[model samples]
Target: MSADGGPVARHSPARAAVRENDTVRSSLEPAGAPEPIGSMLARNAARFGEKAAVRHRSGEGWSELTWARLALDAARLARFMEDAGLRAGERAAVISRNRAEMIVTELAVMGLGAVYVPIFAGYGTEEIGRLLEHAAPRVLFAGGPEELEKVPLDRRPEVVVDYSGRASGGAVPFAEALARAAFSDPGDAEVRRFLERAAAVDPFEPCLMMYTSGTTGRQKGVLLTHDNMLSQQRALSMLWDVSENDRFLSYLPWHHSFGGIFEKTTALYNGALLTLDDSLGKDFDRLLENWKEVKPTVYFSVPKVYQQLYDHVVTHPEQEREVFHEELRFVFTAAAPLPESISRFFADRKIPVLEGWGLTETSPCCTITDMAESRSIPGVVGYPIPGVAIRIAEDGEILVRGPNVMRGYFRDEEATRKALPGDGWFHTGDLGEFYGKALKLVSRKDRVFKLLNAEKVVPTLLENKLAGMNPYIRHVIVVGSGQDFLAALIFPNYYLIRERFGDDIERAEREVRESLRKTIEAFNAEHPVKYERIRAFAVVSRELTVDDEELTPSLKVRVKNVLDRNEPVIDAIYDPSSDCDCRFLRKVFRLVPDSRKCFLGKDKTLDQCHTCGRVVFAEGAPGVGEGSVG
Candidate 1:
């Protein structure tokens, strides 16, 4: 802690601070070489033939898929698609969660040079229908009857393959499709034709059409080619040393690039065994059980999963050895900034915490944290990986140019033009600055809002700080925009609050609010900048949910949806006369005149009010208590 009460950015081993440089491009040159995804799979199948290529929980135990089997199955599936009229350059969509079949479908579609479009499994019937119409895939692979039902009978593709064995709804069972396309002889005409087509596939042509997560706006289909995906693998092969001996336990959805392209591609390209985590990160107990079985060499997930693992190991010390086994190399986290505590935990265990930064259009990996150095600051997402170039725009938005960058948004030239100007640099819309050669992310360009006074506010900075302030804080959304002062809607960790304060609802709310009030005061004092410090905060009664459109499928909060849902609470914050059922931080603010002292005639400074004279006391305010406004 600094004397001013702000967090001091200290290196772990406490090394001398290096001077920040202005270099923008990656320091390392392009290493290794790119290989077509189809070719890479064939090469691996020959080298690691009969070795476990993928694993998943079977009926009572686990089932393994060998490289030879995986390649053969993918080939059979590819043949089925070709028979179903899914020709080259056509799109094939899959709506499924992580499983052994997802990879098979991926390889099948890409092997025939067809575009692979993966829809989020959590998408509603309406969203699924809309994307299916837009993608117009010749073939659709659904996880089961649930996803298959999402597509209207009239709107269903020419062929539908369901992973579930049941053959209802005109959908062929996945196994049945593979069997129908199977040939007895390896050198049969069908097999030879499939191989010839796979070799004829143009690596530069579009092989993937992934939709953006759409946290802030509607989803746009981003078209990526095989070269785009393979380039990232080439870059990582230079930095990482994983081989076929390594193991991976993955739950991240295949619909997104982080899991689909980055994690899954690494496993297949390197011949490593990737166990499909059925838990999908929702059930930690099941995940821990899988952890004991898989003992992954390199784990990749979000911070929430890491926090759960950390909490478990901290409480159950005996399980530490199993959780952090000898084969464990390093852990990678992204999608959001990781808490310093979680990074420290891994660093203490001699496991480097790797954080990467990029957009879906960049094949999701442009920069990676240096493995050689100790963990730097929490937000520093290290130097650019090999073959990628990063440039900080004058306005601070990160611009990227590389083979990994997408060709364009599918069928949306306008959107593509805006993202990728004629100059070749793709605008990432994420704001960041260089710390020496490493990139430290700020806020999303759209998330930065200006107040009525024209003072800009970066909410993510305040949000991250507030999140680390208390364990009870599950999520925080700082809102001020065009208003005189900033405020926050904080979702508390309900389990922890109930554990501490017990079942009485009102009592727990009251106690937690009081505790949060003290912490917010300290946060305000530490951040004296008027626009940065949160002047008011309300403990949100309910948690945000994906069903309510408050969060994306990847669990990213949709800020616009949050604000739209909490309009009343926001109105009440600015206008205290409005009725709102929220409990605000008590005694943290006071309505005062132009004077910098308390309106209650106490020897209190503006620091005590925490409002910095930006708020005024409205008469007959509904929740005002003495000098404070609830």
Candidate 2:
């Protein structure tokens, strides 16, 4: 495996030309010319032939699809798409999870000069409708009935193919569609014609539309050109040293840029073997079961998965953590800010969890911590990619300008113009600061709030601080606008709560709430009035997930949804005496000689409050204490 755990493939012409032109300082590419996406697949097929290109978990066992088979299947699908009247430049939508068939569909769509539009599998009917209206795909591929249900039977595309047999609404089976085209003669002439047209495509012509994970408003379809994808892929390939021998186990949704440009295109460009695992939450056991069998060289996952792995390793310390470390040469954490604690946990085991920063607009990877480099800063997102330029604005927003930047938001010129400035710098809504050579993301611009006292506070920072207080606290969203104090909506980890109180929902909830109250009091005692204080809060019974519409694809909190759902609780926080269920509130009183002297449990009088039974210090009396109200 290469240093970054990708394949050890030869250099493409693009890398060669870039190196010859002295665009990149690294000499990581092999001696060969660059090929377009389709041509690159053909080259890999010719060279690797029978090598496993993809492995998928089936009912009986894991099935392998060789490079030659993948190419042939893709070619058959491409011909079928053509026969179904999918015209050049029209879009082909894949509404599915991470699966082997999804990969083939993408290749087939690109081979026929059609733009690929991947809708997230977790999207609801309304969300899917917005994308379908914008992309207007001629062919739609659904994973199963749940995904197909989002598309009205009469409103679906002309050609609808279902990979899983769960769909019985007259949709064509994926295998049957491929078989129909497989019997016909290979359309080399037609394939070449499409390739020629694709080659003629300009660097700025739209090739894909990836919808942004809508956290604030309606999702915007990001229009990414061939150059956008290729540019990011080339930069990443060189940085990570990707090659044909690398094996990647993909569990992230292919609809997102993380899966599309990074996992899919990067794997294809470098001739890497990509094993598809659509079962994210459901099939994680299957993944752990197959980890030794698959032995993926490079792995990319969100912070939550790593947290789970860390928890598992900690719980079973007798089992060697180094085994997991040795299996992966490079592991990347994206889609959310990885906690310093988690980073340290992996570091202790000699496993580096390199945190990266990017968005859908930049084809998802702009900054990555180098695996070879030992400079692992806790919160910084490391240096920018080879061809990418990063600039910190006066107001702390990070601006990026590179070939990887999207062409624009599809058919939304106003938003495109607003997001991508005239100076070529795309204003990332994320606020960041340059800490040495690396950039530390502070918070999103939208997430920054101005209090009624006119003090600006970044909620993410506070949220992070709160999350670090307890493991059971899955996520916390701070809300304070035109209010005297900040309040939070907490989502407790259901599994942890269940484990703590087996088969007793009410008792589990009460224990979780009391634990959260104690954490809040602890936080209040540690910091000052502005940052450390969360006056009131409520505990949510269930943890937020992508399916619940409370988290983005990257697993960040959906602030708007949380606020909408807990408006009543928020209103009750400000009106403390209101007939609200403020039963979770608790007081931790430390009666010191002076309030200023009390600093994170510094010198204090110790007595219990009569009313609340909270530890308190009396002002003058020795045994009796002034009650601290909740």
Candidate 3:
């Protein structure tokens, strides 16, 4: 039973009975509910055996894996793992990109009642080593040589399988593992008996050990039961109208909950086809190439990726513009707040970029924007999914009660107690509001800081507002603690600035700085408050990226890291003794132009402010901050 005294069943009537005025209920026929994870996979495999389960693009072309094929691969892998001395509750870790083999590994691990741990492919060797130490996986599967190299030599698993063959040395190739297992063929009888035994397992059995993104500190492994994963998948599927026919274009890191559960498992459980894209950073062009060929109906990605894609589209509007309008049905954004400008950009082009909200602890899908709703709210994350209950506590923290919530952080009782309250609902550290059946995330409770005057400010809200002010400002972070006023660290779009200033980089910097200064001055004039007004700022020339550790794998800004790395720059901004330095501080401008302006000709500066750097009245710019330029 949940702490809220609610019955912990396969389905909750309370969730079903919630007002469905703008809600879309699950079309999946209610059943007696098989024992969680493995059963769910088995049921889908049985019902949709011949359906295209997963599709992966290779040099040759698209390689399709039917549900039956996936089941067979998973069964074979399971038998191999069991034969290799894997215990029922032992752990198997997969460090890979989005690939068919990764999915097969997950299914196999879960099918045998063994815990599956997925390490992000983007993680450095040190980060991967830490997670490996924490999870202590008996067997580790690496996607390629790069991922395999990340595995510590001292802690090397008893069994190491490389799916991509890019890795050399003692690791066994994935093909050899399958070929070896084929000779022994666990047989239909043994496979069925193993599956049945696996199905008999309880819902509370831990199926995965997902590690947090480690944004704050050392990452802790989060243990999620089969019920937790399924509940989230079922809830999100119902909310998003996902069906067996729906095709999902997956690019997000497979290790994160959003990608692992919402994007991957949700599609698999519904018998939908998952198109894998391994070309994340090495070749973004290849990702678009895959998209052109796959033409996925549904896509899930982080805000940064969407921002980049929007930039790409805006810059190259003539290239395949019609295809995006006709083929792309819906796009979902998570891991960070979706800027209204980005959302409106897609909405104007007939692409519904829905902003959703969740955390690592909640299996990552608690609320999502509804596609069936009359209008998509730009900033709001829509309503809670079916079977999920959400409420705003008196103190403004968002409280959620659902089966999707994790059992707890693995072996971290103190952290678990700190996260899950004595009350039935889990305290989401985030502050949010429920308006007209929509949920709007405000800021993290821990993120709120006080100024010298004791005025409380939410940096996230202010940053979002500032970033929306102009397309040129790529990323903004407000910084101040026990200080009289707030300051900002701004990363300007070099391409946009250069385009604006022609070939002269110095002129571009000056123009960008002056524009930023005027915008901040105007904002200060309007706000008339120390905490709200950004007094000083430093324009960063470089872009924040996952590789640089300035951003997480999900592409969220690493606030502490950013601040730590640029401490001297931030210090110079706050120092009032120096005037010229302060002038640079007040308006530190970079040479980069907004990526959005790269494609659009310099002749049409539609939303650009003449005097300020802020975006003015562009034809269809969304959200507040219209009328006079900021």
Candidate 4:
């Protein structure tokens, strides 16, 4: 049984004896319940007093804050929050880019027994307002006055703490609060009171209320206790070895669980040095510069960032040594599947590429590729960590039960009941299968949609196939729900296009479009199933962005947002009589009847179809069409 009085299920070691209703779990027993967040910090502070707990860029060089100093600052911040009327069980929200203060803020909030809510920096004003209203925090901590504008006036918290070190809009400056709390006396009354409160925090009470990315629907608040976060660390400690000698350069935002609970706490819990990466995964040039300065022992990031890093290292061979330095251990990637090519690049350099699969609802880590393994299998996220149990539902959905799972969704009992049905397993909504002792992700249950004829199509399978078939296809989203056949929206690799096709912009676009057309035609011919074949496609003009709400912060495509935004393009693709002149809408329009199809091959364009003589021409094809798309 778990420390929370929940039943703990175990699985078999041998795969051959497995049954349909078997529950898979780690061989090791679950660890005992952990101390509260404050107790862990105090312990770490005593052990590594002078050692740098956190590091951040200060002007031309880096500034270090020792573990002892971090503890002191946290106590100070907690005292300040207490003075502002923030109490136990109340919420305190923070909106900021990654900095040392983020770590301080979390410790302070959790120490005071108040819930910590980190808002994604990429969220817009309306999204920010919505979240603020829902959380209804007693105090809000922001990066600066600019973030203040995002919060609606009526929804704004009563107390605001600005990190800019200067007063703005009647908000308390973070620097002033810390400076006021700084005391030469080791036994200050406020600090003692704060420490006492921290030690008294309940292990099973909710300390975090992180919201989901809201890709599928409105974001749900996932309530997790101190034990949920600490239990994950205990599970990881069994599979891997970590210590204070390690260094981490972190940029993953703290708003999401992948970074907030998993990555960030992984470093702090192990007493590792976490450098605040200012780049935030945006500016690669700056990232490489920081990489040279602090050679991280273990790295965590998404596949896209690794791809970019791989490209850079391949081109600049000298910098390869700096990135994959001797002290560097394994690289951990999650949120999306890592392309085999990029994984191979790291493997070639003797760096193991570790991938994981989970959701925010599970404290963000259910399975991680084995630390003993060097090469990763394409889609397999390995065996469950210690204390976790995995079961495959009849419908192929992945189900999990573990000490690390969240308590429930805040203020949404319906969602909580649907997710945790009193069977001890939390419905993951992901489709998967067992690959030996490991788990291979199939697709999201909702991603498999039906056609007008009722045949099902797994969009992820087709998307992966289309993306893998070409070097220039950066992203592919398969679309055709309730339609006759499948179609795709392709985003191109413009960097490769520029390198191969050179300075002539129009010629480059035309040549790439023709190449893609042939690829799609060949793909259609290869797939014999009528429902599986892709009959129409369009290469989007630009890549999707977080600002446009087409992508989540972790870079997952927001499917509904993508579909809604491209309704016009989709209409043109499905409409038989529509002749579109929009930019980048050049299509492989095979969905219509053959009599209306162009007889001329992709290479040779004409003004009209050979059979019907109906006006048919490529939008951007020079002299072949009446109008140009771009």
Taking all chains together, each candidate's TM-score versus the true structure is 0.88, 0.83, 0.83, 0.89
RMSD of every prediction: 7.2, 6.7, 9.4, 5.6
Once all C-alphas are superposed, what RMSD does model 2 give against the true structure? 6.7
Against the true structure, candidate 2 reaches a TM-score of 0.83
Candidates in order have lDDT scores of 0.76, 0.69, 0.70, 0.77
lDDT of 3 by residue, 1-630 (tens): 211232213332223434344232232322335266768667776788778888877677788887767767777788788888787788999988778898888888888888999988777888888778888888889988988877789767889989977678788888777766643332366556655766776778888988887666677888888888877665654444556767777877788888887788778876778888767633557777777777777788876666666666777778646447465677887877666777777777766666678877888777766554425454577666666677787888888877778888887889888788678888888898766566777888878899888999988888877777766787899988887668788888654554456688667765676677667666667775556887656676567878888887777788888888776556544442222222122233212223233111211346443333344333322211211212
Candidate 4: worst-modelled 10 consecutive residues by lDDT: 8-17
Candidates in descending lDDT order? 4, 1, 3, 2
Off by over 4 Å in 4: 1-21, 30-32, 182-193, 495-511, 514-530, 579-581, 584-616, 619-628
User: Candidate 4 lDDT, tens digit per residue, 1-630?
Assistant: 221232222232222122344566776644556768887787787789889989999999999988877878888888788888999999999988878888888999999899999998678888899889889999999998778878788988778999986646788889877776657343456555666678679988999999998778899999999988888887777666667777888988889888888888999998988998888887777988898888888889987678777767766678788888877777899988777778778888877778888999888888877645666676788878777888998999999988889999989999999999999899988998888778888899988899999998888877766766666787788999898777788888765565566799888877887777677877878888867888767777787787898878888889889888776567656654544445435444443333343322221335553423445445443322221243
Residue 133 in model 1: lDDT: 88
Report lDDT (Cα) of residue 496, candidate 3. Answer: 55
Clashing pairs in 2: 7-243, 7-246, 8-243, 9-243, 9-244, 11-30, 12-34, 13-33, 13-34
Better of 1 and 4 by TM-score: 4
Which structure is stronger by TM-score: 2 or 4?
4
Ten-residue stretch with the least lDDT total in model 1 = 8-17
Candidate 3 Cα RMSD (Å) = 9.4
* Order of the predicted models by TM-score, top scorer first: 4, 1, 3, 2
Q: Which candidate do you rate higher for TM-score, 1 or 3?
A: 1
The digit string of per-residue lDDT tens for model 2 on 447-523 reads: 88877888777888788778877877778788887765677777776655554577996676557656776787788
